[model samples]
Target chain A: MPFRHLLLSLACFIVFSCKNETTPAPSKATSQRPDPHSLADPFNDKMLELQLKLKVDFDKKILSGSASWSFDRKEKTNEIIFDTDNLTNRKSDPWERRNPNHLYARTP
Target chain B: MTLGKEETPTTFTLEPRDSILGSALRIKLSPNTNYLTIHYSTLPEAAALGWMDASMTAGKKRPFLFTQGQAILSRTWFPCVDSPSSRFTYAAEIETPDGMMALMSAKNPQQVSPDGMYKFEMDKPVPPYLVALAVGDISFQPIGKRTGIYAEPSMLKKAAWEFADMEKMVETAEGLYGPYDWGRYDVLVLPTGFPFGGMENPILTFATPTVITGDRSLVSLVAHELAHSWSGNLVTNATWDDFWMNEGFTVYFERRIMEALYGAEYVEMLAQLEFWELEDEVRAFGEKNPDTHLKGNLKGRNPDDGVGDIAYQKGASFLLMLERLTDRNKWDEFLKNWFQANKFTSKTTEDFLAYLKTDYLEKHGLTANVDEWVYGPGIPANCPRPNSTKLAIAEKAATNIVNAIPATKEWTPHEWVHFVRNLPKKTTVETLKKLDSQFNLTNSGNAEIRCAWYDTAIRRGYVKEILPQVEEFLVGIGRRRFLMPVYTALKETGHVEDARRIFTKAKPGYHAVSYGSIEQLLK
Candidate 1:
């Protein structure tokens, strides 16, 4: 019974060793390569909805806004950007483009 | 809040319940009731705007907070998250007098009911510094497609006419850039002395009374604020550390818009003057300290400090240099690309440089030494030049003036004329001062010579001290017939008190337009 058990254990070890030997090592190029298409969001990788409120007093020459941004964290980035939405009150022009909010992640 | 010392340097914690980006926090601070629960992006106001007579202090008498007011006390009013880089959106519900009008960000225009209360909505996001509010009786004008609102009931008509070019400029800018994502544009004409130059608050801009040239030449400021629609309002800076991002980009954009409106010569001159102004700022700040970090300088200073000529001068020159290095087509493409890529987001100097270096500069065969110019002290040496096109044009003008001296007006001209016309290519301030002595209008000199002498003196910075004499020459010609630019510059430089005296002396000779314009500025 002892001899039979020893032979079974040896067979199992051989099978495991043979499987490990057949598996190829990861190549250097594969390890170093990062997907070029994965462009990180300037604000953050997390894509989330945001809400903002802007107020303008044309008479008093006062412009202000309130905003609540909802974003998720997928990966860390260098900075985040927010737009100044106060431009909604002004008339549009073809030459001067509209202003948009932005984000830049923190950089070490 | 109680404080405790730890020998092992207290470990920090972050509880960002109010943060927009999934509870991101940098530092650990104990929660305390004394700490105000601030929300949204807006200027900090200690007292609500209304007939709260008690909130009205002695400082209220000043015109638009030139001394101290709500805008100045933004620090005391709120926790002052003073970083322009930390961009986020804010949602606020302000409870004010039922009859008062409340405005913020880009919001749907509100309607006033019988209750006299108004509420506006701005769904677009914004930063804290760009937040603002003005409470007063105001009027509106529909001169063009866009609406112009004036805080003063009487100024609405004038405001409408003055801002007539808004639609045209915006349309032109949109063509050059992409379509403006933000819907409409508007201006709030508050009382005089707006503290800072003008805050380009997203859709609505808060303008200083000084900027209003009832004649509407103040369009440059409008163009500038409009340009900010893209530079500041759209692509915001990540932090105050990169103020040049907000200012430099805005200044460059403003000049581009102005160049589109005015001739290149005018824009070129403005650029030259702006460069000199930046030099002046650097010299002044250099005298005190070498640090040119705008954040350090703008601290406790007026709003204008945040946007001095350095932003214009250093910032524009940087772009001009970039244009020179990267050719016009490539530069334009780069700008368009950057704007498109980073629209409606906050950014930093590093991100800007990084993206440009990799995507634009590297791909387009340009230098990655942008940092040497942007982050370093002083202007870059041996900056790339855009050929001798501008210089050749200027030289041509000088040659034309020199060659066409009219045989009659050349040899027989006054000594002053000969001395000035024969001046070397470059004249130092001291050298110019010495030459000023040789000019005496009282002598028998023709109008051209006298005008030339006056121009030289003005260039040399003696126009103000010798205003009486400049006025004497100007009045003889009748100031009304003069070009508007020169007259405007002179009026701007001339002290209000001195102008009052000079105008009083020759009240009848003053052109109604010029006279009216000067009076408005003085007020």
Candidate 2:
């Protein structure tokens, strides 16, 4: 009976470990010595590459576009910060591995 | 926003906006996230961007657009880590109106794209501020294999001729430093509304049309911008407080390039003029002000406030002092190594001091008054004073002119500027009339000479004679360097109403960077 109980406990532990792997816990915010003129914590999550697709609108006198950024997460930080002024219509999209159209492809 | 390759929906929040620093955009990321895309638009009056109608261009046929992203203005256009320490490589697909040429601080195309879709890539990591763009009815003329000029078709030939020695300048700069790391050294002559003299934007420099004086006398501005390839672009200042690291080193390198091309006597005049400007700034700011220090404390102020003689001239003077103390060959070697070692990186004043202590100073077993020069307020006792025989002659002529001695007619633009700047303070309007009659100062084409003459004219109460030209200049030119003093002079000389009138007419033509200060001054 004891051997059967030990087997059942082992199975429960394995299932829990697999579930933990599939669903990562929410990351905690990291602290850094901020740049006085900027609120970005580049030390925690540093931008490595940027891809922009922008349209110049002469009549409206604005630049509307999407800025895709690739960065290296130095620690388990919850967020990445960027400086912006007088920018509007902002919509943020996080990467989704299952979306084929959202793969690392340049705008055509 | 999307994160990583999976295109998962992400959450973001635009934090409360600060009056000076602007807004901070924060986005949550998964543990595996490496990519995030933000879709946005810039407002019409974005501080870094200048949009001009056809009327503003030399051709007056097609509209023009340019961006000046130095200091902290880059954040006004794009969402990025706008700090100087944050460096990133970029690829951009910019769509413009058909028939317009688009260029960036990247690998540029000489011709306009047929579909109005232009692609640019900067393989090297650069601070976001250096990423620039311009779209207009522009054309390019190759000055050499790796040098060229870009301007409106109407102004192309004149610009090409004015910057004829651009190819030689690249070679001269390379011979001094390691290499012209940014492949091609080309200049884009923007419309009259360009606020600054020149913005060093990696491979492509955005220059003011004012620099095309037809005499090639102002090409030193080209050298100054090009020197930034090594000083400001390659190795950037980590913060605005350490801005001297960018301007001072570039100024020093610029003089060396000028010396290589125009000889030492010519550079001496240039250095002497800069020293005089520095002196005037020190007097205006009060000698004990901390802002006069090389490394300023700009924690709560706009970084633009730091863009003055303290960063450019005082910074250069400090480097010149170091060169004076050390052997030229050793100094050159140290500088080359410094550039090579710190290329594509941002550094602070402390970082440079530590490097100097370790590599150059300790290696030479030398001790210098670096502390007094950088930390202490005002110019130090050890500050090297550049003496110019040319300027001496101009000063004597200024004195002679007051004594009814006729001014020499065969002076270079530098000497003319020195003469105009050194005019007697107490000279009567009659003396001014005599000088203007001789020099035709009111009708001078050279922007530098015109600006200096106007400042003197405004101070000597000769505004009545030069008011029309002053209005024309204030209206036509948008360079802040020329605009600020002229406007200030008008205001200080009890001509605030006049300043307001001209500014009201000129404000629309000025870029936000230029108009913002004038708006405050007028207020």
Candidate 3:
């Protein structure tokens, strides 16, 4: 009975180590001062440079463009946030249909 | 969305919108991902963008577009951190309609692009709000080797003549602070509908056509904007709450530049007028209102709410007090060192106070009412009193208009403003009519004088005589500085119906910044 219990404990430890390796690490907390107006966490991940290629449409009064952001990721976060107002994404993604309010509910 | 040059697909989440702050765009990053690109478009009603039809422009031939992004409007045009705390270098390829030129707050092209494709590069890391762009039937003329003017072809000569002292202003400013880091300084004269007097977009300053008063009397607005190169563009406020740091410092620096170029007497008139404006604003907000404090609490509110005379005048008053405490040479040295130390960084109010404590106060072994001036409500007791001999003459002239008419012959715009603003509140409409008929105040080509005259006219019940001119002035100019007082007077004097009517006709032409304030006032 003792030998069997030891073998079972060893198997449990191996399974836990494998799970840890597969899962991504959590991001570390940042020390930068908070900006009440923005939702970006610039201390953790910040954009270093930006490249823009935009076409002006006077008829529509809109600017269609590709904004390429070169960033430095200080932490291990899987997501980087930016601020936008009155802009539309040209490309459709799976999350396009997701309710943003619902996603906000999931956020801390 | 794609990652880097490989164009690998990535996932992003668009958060729910807040009424004031808009929405947040969250993009997923892989373990090794360091770059991502977003493909998006700006909505027509973006608050920062002012898209004008040809009929609204000065030339009345080609359309014009400009952007005003200060105080959290940049996010409306492009996705970014959208906070002064974040700074980055940017490069762009802007394509415009054929025959039009594009300019930005970056290295610009002197001539129009034959193919309507223009490239810009801003190597220095600047706050996102300073990223500006303008496209229109614009032409450029050089004032000096490093200074120039951009305007509609029709207004080019007048604007260039008005701002001929641009090179001198830059040289004087550099003499005071440090080198003008941005390579070139240029001014673009937008259509009459441009809201503010001037926006200090680095490398290029967006000015209103209204400033081109033909006499160059209102060019202090240029000096003010140019001063921002050292105070605002170089050293920024970390958050909107610390906006006084940007504006107050610029106002002080502007006066210094003006004093260096013109003289003490000229700049003193400017300072005196601002002091009166500040006092009136304090009374309007009530002396104890927290918003009057230099270090504002703008959490959960529009930052623009804190941008009245308090930030511009009260903040400068605090600096003036410091200068009076220490000698001018010592203050100048301290300020020069302060700007050099924080050249490209955004600083909060606390950061500044700490720096001052260590660098200025401790070094000089002096103490000041810093807390009372910054965090306390209203203007402090120790505020400096600006005494302008010319303004005193203007005030005396306002007391007796008949005797003062001849004296006004040599009056500058500042003196005119002081005279009109100091007019007796109980003066009869007949007196106003006589004054207007003599001076042609209703038809004054100078916007500052016109705005001041209109405010007095509306208050003293003289609106009936100049009703047509008032409506024309209100509809023609979109500057909030000129619009607010006249509208408020109309409402306060029981003309809400008239105010609403004029605003309905004028709202579409006003930029979001101007209309937003007016809408709140009328509401």
Candidate 4:
């Protein structure tokens, strides 16, 4: 009975310590630590079909293109991720920032 | 952009994937996400795309833009699985000015239409490296039934004449290999400073104007790219480590194509040139240098670092030795079968060895030290030597020059390659002048011969009379094959000031591929 109580107390201490730990918010300054699941492509979860519509502006030296990717889901997964750097509405190249929903996390 | 299973819009981020290469993407999506749309643009400094203004082009009226996607640079231009292992068919819709036309490594439209938007389709599933695009005031001229050449309106006729034998070359290649899988093989002669000699983009080859020497002497560049249709475009290397699989096989096949069109002796001269360059590279990178290995360990490094003479010369030499070991007919048959089997698939060094073992060594009782050839640090001891009997004549003539015995001679491009390559290292300026007067090498239209002469002059400090011509050649052409040795020789001979001056003028015109190396060299 005493051993079981001690074990329960130790588990409680570990849980309490873990609960006190906090994760820093994601930022533009990328973390040096690599993500465990980071890979060349995230589209491998399903068979995919892609379409891209692009326009070149010589004066500005920018190539703006619209990419559409359609995938057929096969498994039971909540979220699917793709690799992107300058494709979002964050900064430079200004990707439809006039609208809302611009929350992104540096996947480290 | 639409995001997840509910078709809701969201954002994404780029995560650092590998250390040396570019980044990867991470986007969150819903479980049943059928489609995600992204509106994107490439920056002006995008590594894969090169934009040349009107001033930089032959036709100063229309601007030029082109895309180079090989060796993982494609990711910088756009987002995708930018690896050689990932392949998918693509179609492009490019909008250009009314007078200009856009072309890709795909089925190109025949004539210019009222709408400036050019639509191109590539049915073949190719890796990102092969997705090439070039847009400019381009015109095409038919050489033979299935072969043609494309260039600016001013240079079209000359390019057509220079590549008159394209059809014959293609037929000869088909006769050796199986068939010309890519329909309507065409050539695009970019501006004078179009980086490489020839890029093996499928359906169309992007070539440099330096190869249009009027004498058709440098058409070997064409042969090399045609050979790539089988080795690189059809059967590709999965990563840069197995680069020799693309180049070595292409070099061997290139020599065969040359031998079929031209004579054996002509190919022999070219082989001798390859030998000298390989020796120079092996000396530069010591015999024990890991970079000397055919199947290189190029992880976490610039893939371009592996683009050296070892993969080209030593790789071809290994295959040549294997050919010498087996019967000629059987070797040809094996190569034909190999190409047909691995068509449109990516391969690794290990995969090739397994094929060789199962397909040839075990079955036909053939033998080769496959590990020593591919995985070892240097050239194998038993590498088959290339013979250039005509080069022997040139060597004899070169020896005769030092002895003050002038032998009367008629020189072709092959002989010039041999004579210049065999020139005495310590030949005085006066001697070069005498040879230059006799052969007119300083004024030679051939880029290879001119490069050889400039390399010699740079080493010997005979810059008095040749400086003007050398400077012109240096600033005019941006091919690393021609520029690298000259700049190295200049630096070695204590002419950093002169090399820097020329590179300053030339750097703006060079593609990023050539610019990156020369920038470091001049620095």
B472 Cα displacement, candidate 2 (Å) = 0.7
Give me the candidate number with maximum TM-score.
2
- Higher-lDDT candidate of 1 and 3: 3
TM-score of each: 0.54, 0.91, 0.90, 0.87
Compute the DockQ of candidate 3: 0.23
lDDT for residue B325 in candidate 4, whole number 0-100: 80
User: What TM-score should be assigned to candidate 1?
Assistant: 0.54
Of 1 and 2, the candidate ahead on TM-score is 2
What does the lDDT read for residue B248 in candidate 1?
Answer: 83
Off by over 4 Å in 2: A1-34, A90-108, B1-5
TM-score of 3: 0.90
- In Å, residue B438's CA in model 4 sits off its true spot by 2.9
DockQ of each candidate relative to the true complex: 0.03, 0.24, 0.23, 0.15
Question: For model 2, how does the per-residue alpha-carbon lDDT over B173-274 read when each residue is reduced to its tens digit?
Answer: 889989889899899999999999999999999999999988888999999999999999999999888999999999999999999999999999999999
Once model 4 is optimally superposed onto the true structure by TM-score, how far is the C-alpha of residue B218 displaced, in angstroms?
1.4
For candidate 1, the per-residue lDDT at B49 reads 23
For model 3, which pairs clash? none
Q: For candidate 1, lDDT tens digit of each residue in A1-108? A: 000111122233223323422442222112121211111132332323233333433234333332333444434322332221111111222211221111111111
Instruction: Give the alpha-carbon lDDT of every model.
Output: 0.46, 0.85, 0.83, 0.74
Best by lDDT: 2
Per-candidate alpha-carbon RMSD to the true structure: 19.6, 8.9, 9.0, 8.6
Give fnat, all candidates: 0.04, 0.59, 0.56, 0.30
Q: What is the lDDT of residue B55 in candidate 1?
A: 16
